[model samples]
Target: MTFRARLVGAALAGTLAAGASALAGASAASAQAEPCVQRIAVVNNAAFVMSFSVQASNGLETANTDTYPINQSRTIDLTTTALPVSADVRPVVDAVAGATRTPSSFVSYCENGQTATYSVTGTTYDYSVTLIG
Candidate 1:
């Protein structure tokens, strides 16, 4: 090939290689920076209402206290919240007339793209919550 044509070809090849390298670097960085998504579902099997609160390790908190009816489930999305590696889930049941029942068991370590289910079940005035999955 002519010298001028060869030089231009080499320059174009170098530019393409540099661009490809930069694109690969950017893709790697973005993959590492992507946040995890957690899907949490709370099931109430008791006779009364139940409430729940979820807090991420990064101090992001989400709660649902709208009186979850019996035999129903509520799902919360924690993808937008800044969760570090785990999260804290607190559940309370309104089993009694003027009292609240707080479950001793809670959920931790919510994984990415996984669904965690918390089920609350018991007789009236004696409710319990446990992580089923």
Candidate 2:
């Protein structure tokens, strides 16, 4: 699992927060800060398999001495590990001025086997969750 990519969960939370703010305006702050509301959708671009040494061959063996690869996939369900990455509704509210709203959602794209986080600030919350393929 791309734990680094999981960081995107925070960014994802931020986007969701921004969207809530846009719809609720002043009330978005009161809303519970959460990342992956229920079943967050991630476009299954590809699946990447990471090999971990569940058990070492011997005491001298390292946990991740061996390496493996799995295809990367999009359209991931975050409900199972539904945990808030981060929370920051204040900054989002502060940024929102008149018609110009910061970012209400994340427009993520994968490049070079990594999901590129776009330009979005304040609203993005950072969280972590377990992913199973």
Q: List the residue pairs that clash in candidate 1.
A: none
Write the residue-wise lDDT of candidate 1 on 53-131 in tens digits. Answer: 6654345666554666788888766664454454554444454453565545545544667666778777666667776
lDDT of 2 by residue, 58-89 (tens): 21211221222223222222222222322221
Q: What is each predicted model's overall lDDT from 0 to 1? A: 0.63, 0.28
Q: Provide TM-scores for the models.
A: 0.52, 0.18
Segments in model 1 whose C-alpha atoms lie over 4 Å from true places: 1-37, 56-60, 82-85, 88-106, 109-111
TM match of model 2 to true structure: 0.18
